[model samples]
Target chain A: MTVGILFDMTKCIGCGACADACKEQNKLPGPVEEVTTAYTWTTVEAREGQYVRHLCMHCLVPTCASVCPVAALHKTPEGPVVYDADKCMGCRYCMMACPFDVPKYQWDRAIPIIGKCIMCTSRVKQGEATACATACPAEATVFGSRADMLKEAKERIRKEPDKYIDHVYGLKEAGGTGVLMISGVPFEKMGLKAKLTDEPPAMRTWQVLSNIPDFVAVWGVFLYGVHWITARRDTVAHHEAARKGPDTIDTTHTGRPS
Target chain B: MNSTATLPAGRFRLGFWTTVFALLTIPFLAITFLRFSKGLGAVTNLSDKFPWGLWIGFDLLCGVGLAAGAFTLTAVVHLFNLKRFEPIVRPTILTGFLGYIFVILALMFDLGQPWRIWHTIIYWNPHSVMFEVGWCVMLYTTVLSLEFAPVVLERFGFHAPVRMIHRLITPLVIAGVILSTLHQSSLGTLYLIVPSKLHPLWYSQLLPLFFYISAIGAGIGMVILESYMSKRAFGRHLEMDLLEPLARAMVVALGIYGLMRIQVIVRNGSYADVLNLTYEGKMFLLEFVLGVLLPVGLLAFRKLRTSPTWLVVGAFSAVLGFVVNRLNVSVTGMERASGIRYVPSVMEVIVSVTLIGIGMAAFALAVRYLKIFPEEKPAEEPEPEGS
Candidate 1:
């Protein structure tokens, strides 16, 4: 039921229509930018003699969403990773954590917030294709249910093995992003992070964070146990000193009187 | 120096260093105003490619790490029942409290929306490492305040509150240690999300453990340095007997940290990267040599550990190493992947320096007014001549 986009680089004609439609749909200002910025949500770049679109990958388990201390960025059930500016304290942790370097900051504004593509969640929710997908004259970018889009991408590669690369870039990178890409050129040559682990990065941090309760429990008991044993030892030593003659001083104990 | 010592106790004096700090504060204030009015882009060299810079690297990471002495000493004195260490406890706690305060102050500038900092308390994101760090820091600062409260309360003759706090002292110390452990390690966990982005030289699954162990070494080093400085400034007797044992502890910490660093590099099969002699490789070597090998090798010998001069040198080297290591993780390790050569702006450096000056000034004021030292002797002797 989750919506998604599959961008076929081979079909992209370097027309820049998707970029224009994105700017217009988002109400962004001015001519289309050559690269993604806080104001520009998406950009089409020339790489390896082909057009490659750059924007938020909107991962299945978004590192940006997980790293956000204020829950400003989160994955919607419908498929997109959305951002809430009101909840954001502008820590910029999202910008730091995003694997794709997707999140951009309004760094010039006095009251800045994070800016990134939200996967056109409003249009996707209305059962319509994203602005870029709708405007793709060559059918380079297509929107559909995630399951269907993934299957279609697989089918395309299987049907024309020699024409397409044998890989889907987002199918496993950063634990599988919602925006999948099938390219005729090798992903690495096209400037993609081709060697990222299949596992989500958030899980690495979670592996440590999940142990907090156990650590607190054991560490607390151990500290208290040490305190108790030492306190008893001090008391016993004090009593032994008392039993000894006044002339025999206990130089071993330097602790203050409890 | 002798004339200032002749002045009445509990009176603040404007010394040469104090005047220098005041002069430094002027630029910091102006830059701070410009920062807020024009935004972070105007004052810092940060970009979309490099979101963090010197502020997070030095001001927050190194500041918090150096302050780890407070928890370590408290646990040693209170939990382990080693009362010989009780003398330095109050000052360490004061340093920690002030260090955290300045960290929060630095954060106020780094954050694009400083006013909503409290949103961490309101908003819930248990999955976030930053959330855990935020909660632990907030709670630990409160714990530190309560631990140090007795010193202030007793000064003002607030006997009842002091006694009540004394009753709760053990629990407070325990809480402080627990909170410090969580956040100190969690700071490393913040980098876990950047496994690929951070260079292989610094990145490891054992980052949290590495951070924790190194913090212990730096904490002990800070204690040594603080004692030496206190002796020079106030003509206080050097606790050579106590510092000798702490030096030994520093040796053990550094040894463990060094061993772990090697183990990680070997396990990752990245020893070749260490010998690659690239920028990151050289920085890593520098960090290891300065932070670990030199300090450990210097302090491991009984003859050197017992010597005050050598002990101070080893401690300073270790502290410097810690700063370098943190910067390596925050800036150097990330440079190539970010594709931007990030050098902090002048205003950024000034802000960081001013924060340190403020911390030092605050410590001086506390030493003057508060009963930081157990043996209350007036500053009758002349200050020491050399560093």
Candidate 2:
């Protein structure tokens, strides 16, 4: 029942019509302020003779959800990385964790919150597709359950190997993003990062985290021992100095046995 | 701590409202207003590509790292009973307190919804590194306050509470030291999320170790700088006799940090990157040479280490080097794949400037009013020969 987008990049026309239709349906302010205020849930990035749609992939294992300290950004069971402004503390760590940089900040507001495509969950729940998918003149932006989309993508690639690159992004990257893509060219040439591991982003930190308790205990004992040894030595030095007359020990004497 | 000097007839030559503080506050106030009114964007030039700007890099990261001196010295003096270093404990703590307070301020401004800061504590995401950092920082700040409370009690002549606190100081100090170690290393762990984005030379599972070592080195350097500044500004004597031995310790720390830095680079198989010598390579070399190698070289020489002027110079170099290192990690090292570059706007600079200036002003006022430095007991009149 988890919904997602399956963008077939080979079918996209660099026309920016999807962007326009997205703004119109969402009642966005339009591209005039896309750099700041325009809410183009989907926009076309023309890179190296190919067009790519930049939007939330709605990962199956969302790094943004895991890293968010306040649970402001979350992944719904129905399959969307949803934003809750009330919960957002505005730390923006989620922005850093997202490989796609899909989340946008409403930086112009005095108390801004994160803004991102939520898979248009409201419309989709009513049995309609996302505005970008519905408005795509070329039917390039396909919508369905991720499982069905993945199956369809494999069929298309097998049916026409020459027409598609031998890759499906978001299948396993950052732990299997919901939105999948197929293109005619290499991903790197299409302005997408190549070679990211399929493992969850937070997986990188697990090693350090797993050993933290051990490190803390070992370091604690070592430091405590140093404190004890130094204290004992200082006590002995103090006693020996006390036995002698005043001024028996000097600064140079303390420098020894280091 | 107590002051032997009688109250001065007048204030310092350059008082709190000096031209520097005044000039600095203009930017600070302007930036503060804009930041609150227009959100962080109006003040900073940060974007989704570069979420953390200079404040997080400089103030919270580098500032807290340098301030590690307080607990390190506290552990050495109070816990280890090093009488020679006793003169430094209070001043070290004061510096640490001021530095940490400023870090919190910087963090507040950097956050988009400053109000949601409490959500970290209330919501409780125990699995996250940031959660650990947030909890540890808050707890440590509390511990620092408790550890520092005896000073205030002493100042106010609250003997009963002071005695109770003195008895508990050892356990409190141990707790503070433990918390500081966890959070300082956790700060470095924040970058583990961006393994690919962080320059390979700086990225490692050993990041926490590298951060801990460099923080110790930076903390020592900060103490030396503070010592030098106090001598120059307040006519206090330079603690060359104590600082000389400390310089040797600094050398040891720097040596280890340098070795670890190189080791991590090799272990990560980034040796070729340094040898190839691209822009990142040159900067990497610059951090290694100026921040690390030079200070280690200078401090390793016994004669140079003991010299007051040379020790101060080496300490300054080490402090700047650490600052550069932190900036490299938090800002310069990030891979902005979207080709986005951030140069903090004027307002952003102003806000950051204000925080530092206000911090310095606060430090100066505390030193003036509170017993920060140990009292210099005057020479007693020579007793009668037969008495």
Candidate 3:
């Protein structure tokens, strides 16, 4: 159904209620704070009294999913990019691949795994909104289908053109993320840095690696051809030397006819 | 058989490097214990922001690149039938085999769940760049072993298998070359997904090409450096005839790499903001100049390329600069997006050096026991047929 989130930064009240609800709902051990971690999946970054809640952007073609060796991080059909700790071999490549720097890690443990918002996949599957979205004191965080959220985001921007910046944060960044954000202030001013190509990063890898099979065939044939040609010449040279008398041909150390 | 064949001639010499190596290894063993027992957090400075460190950068990336001489020289001698270069084929293959082993060993420490590394084979995420690199490395390591098997088999008098390997040698080397090319470039593909995170100076569509070309240069440099060290340590006479042509070839390789790098940087027009002095700019300049331009210049001249001392100097510079290049790509290249710098811990340094020490010791052991160098005969008239 392509479920997604529409975070209206203008409506946010800079309260820690959403963060607290995320901690409670996810059963996270540590208290919620400005920075996220293994325990904290969501947090609010406040700049000049303007609040921007930080969590996974849940990209359409997630770089983390493409970079993972074991396919631990996967994007559900409904839209959340979820991580499986059981399948995770602790490469931490997802942590590096995320453009928004979303995924956090359990660096304190003997065996570490990454942490990030999964958009409450279990609850969302059961037709319930995310913990953070539901606990919002105001209608700042809205959960709906991606098409609906995108329509609402564009409508809000069009209705009050002067009141809002003429940009949707996740609409095109990193190849169109599932979560959309509209802010009164410029998104970058709220410390939400996400300047990237509209195309997914996975395409960048494939652009080069896709040529491998063709290269293998071409290179293999070229090498064999050279081997055959040189071997034939060496054989013919040996035959020519063998035709001469034993006293005439000097072939010691050559492993050829004497 | 002489004692030198059975054991290293200076078995009990216990030189200063030996003592230094021992000192580093003892602490490294202790650190490895803490790393496994207490976790990576106890010994490494790695965090969520900096997941990979010295182990992946130096040990895996640079280690693999430096060992490129194996496939490169093997193809030259076997596929192209360059008979003059035959003496170095085995040594390069041995170096390549040892380098992959070291990479696997380093991964045991870096992987979060080292035991599940094999899970990639079964899970099969073809979309993942790591998946492709993983399969290529595993397959290539196998190919390298088979390519090297004849040497070991011949040493131990296993003739039947040696003959079998001889028949299989051409195909084995071809497979090795293909696999090497795939993973070497795929290693660069790992960083392609981080275009936003990596500095534009290092990130580009042509990263794989740059990686493959630089690997060829690095491989040539490593062979030169290794040959010099072996000659110095084992008292084997240098093969001037072979090295002179090798130096000429290295110059061409480095020149090609440098040209491509310049074209990429100019096309990106990304690092043009060099007026504002930054650490990234400095590192970029260092890597480009010393690693590419300086070495190319050194080996271009006929006089310098022919002289063993000058050739070795150029090779050493290229190797050291290429090592820094890998570090720059992995760690320094991401400094802007990360907004944090990662310096290796003392324990990390100790472990890396100790691993290198172990690899060198293994190489030395092989050289002493195996027929690594061509047998040297005294320059004299042939013995009488009666004798």
Candidate 4:
């Protein structure tokens, strides 16, 4: 039930077919010469020595899902982080929270919706392959259950040790992502960061804010008590002073007792 | 009863809404049109990278921060029971109420879907700091209104409810102060989520503490500014007898804020960022100098505290400094991850201009109609008995 994609960059021929098919299937505008909304969900970024396809990794514990205040972006039980435009208030809290910056805004629109890949969940439910997996002329991309794809990725690296790099990207990055990658070049050289910690970015802030309610409640009671005691003392002192005439009364012993 | 108490019984003042204020509203109206019709993108230079802009930076952040004057004064006068400062209580509360009204107005503009603002209640995300800030702000606004209601009722010649409300004002004022304190600190806590994104100098775990302390300093600065302006505009005497003691408190407040800020800097080992030759570094120095150092130095002097001109100058500087700090957090400090820089277009500036224009005009109207200033005492009256 847990399906995923394995994009092996060592075998890709840098063809624009997969990207083209994605645009058509998703009803996006046709591809431009450079990557943009009209064409670019699957972008081919030029690394130092290789070209890497960039798209949402569809993380297991999606940072995008955790940060969306209105729950516009979410993780489905099947595993892809999907965007629900109807619920989107477009506050863009997810943008700041995402380390990879996958979700893009349609800035040109009068009323824009956040845009991100949904892992072709519709095709998966229909028991068909994704457009990119189906259209790959070189068999560069493979689609199957995450466990199966992961096993195949490790087996390929093991059989031909020198042909592929000794690393599997996205297997455990950001608390393990759904999409796995086997690249000939190092991930850092492929313009993909391998430095992100397993901890979701929003937790640090939540931890601090969670402590406030308790503090505020305690502080509120303390301040109210102080206000009461002070006011009552003033009232008593005022009554005491009123009993004495102004001519002989001393002002020093006024509010509160001497 | 004086002629003033009977309500000015003549034609409305013709020049009441100044030409400048009217002119400012034109852009505001137009910007509002584009905002609703074309959406937030049309009216603001806001990107996903910068979700908040000038309205939040100026009106809600600095405005509410400055409005801290009300609670600070109320706490000093009512809690500490400093009888000499009683004349300022009503005016301070009025300013706080108006400032809060402006805050709600600003929020309305900044919201991407203003219609769904009510969803904060229906879909309450208890873990979200924003949920806390939203509820706190709404509750505090209510507290301020109730704390200020007696003043309005007193003017309308309603004595019974006024007396009943008077009994609750003391507790209401305390509740209002506590709520304000929570939200004001939480405002800074909102930014703590983006530690890596915020500039090192501005980003710290101590953000909440710094925000709370700076608000108090800004609030005192606002009081000084208000007292000075009233003296010039209404020909009222500057209340230095009260302000002299207040200036001493401000000195201590600013001193604590300054030390705490430096302590944070040192603890983060980002103290070197202050001396770093980067744009963020320069801005940090400017925030430190104008917001904390210069104001503290001026207020510390007894002679400066007594002089209306120096006090006003110090206060204005502090206010400007607080505004800069907010802008730095919201706009200037966010490093460009998208490789795009944000510059507010004319429409964005127009909407911001309108909000400020309306706030000023509304403030002027309140001053004219609400009996905001305390009535001047008789020339040769005997000294009133003290409590």
Each candidate: chain B TM-score? 0.94, 0.93, 0.94, 0.91
Clashing pairs in 2: none
TM-score of each: 0.96, 0.90, 0.95, 0.87
lDDT of each: 0.88, 0.77, 0.83, 0.73
The pairs that clash in candidate 4 are none
Ranking by DockQ: 1, 3, 2, 4
Candidate 3 on B37-75: residue-level lDDT in tens? 777888888887788889988999998899899999988
Q: Name the candidate that leads on DockQ.
A: 1
Which residue segments of model 1 deviate by more than 4 Å? A249-251, A254-258, B1-16, B376-387
Give per-residue CA lDDT, model 4, range A97-132, as digits (tens).
666767766655656677777778788778788888
Better of 3 and 4 by DockQ: 3
i-RMS, each model, one decimal: 1.1, 2.4, 2.3, 3.1
Off by over 4 Å in 3: A243-258, B1-10, B271-277, B380-387
C-alpha lDDT of residue B33 in model 3: 87
Model 4, span B1-387: residue lDDT tens: 122322353555545446666776777787787777777777788765555667777777887888888888877776666656777877777778778888888777766666666666666555556667778778888987887787678778888988887787677777787878887887787777665567667878788878888888888888877777655444466677777777777778878988987887788877776676577778878887888888889988989877766777788888778878877776667754345666677876666666666766665566667767667654522212100
Worst 10 residues of 3 chain B by lDDT: B378-387
Evaluation by lDDT, superior candidate among 2 and 3: 3
Q: What's the C-alpha lDDT at position B101 in model 3?
A: 88
**Higher-DockQ candidate of 1 and 3:** 1
TM-score of chain A of 4: 0.84
| lDDT by residue (tens digit), candidate 2, B1-387 | 222433242666866456777878766776778789878777788876788878888888887898899888888776676667988877788888888888889888988877778888778665567877777778888887777777778878988987887888777788788888888888888888776577787778778878888898889999999988766556566667778878787888889999988888888787777899865677688778767888998889988887777788899988988988888788767744446655677776777777877877776666677777777655422112211
Top-lDDT structure, candidate number: 1
DockQ (model 2, Cα): 0.53
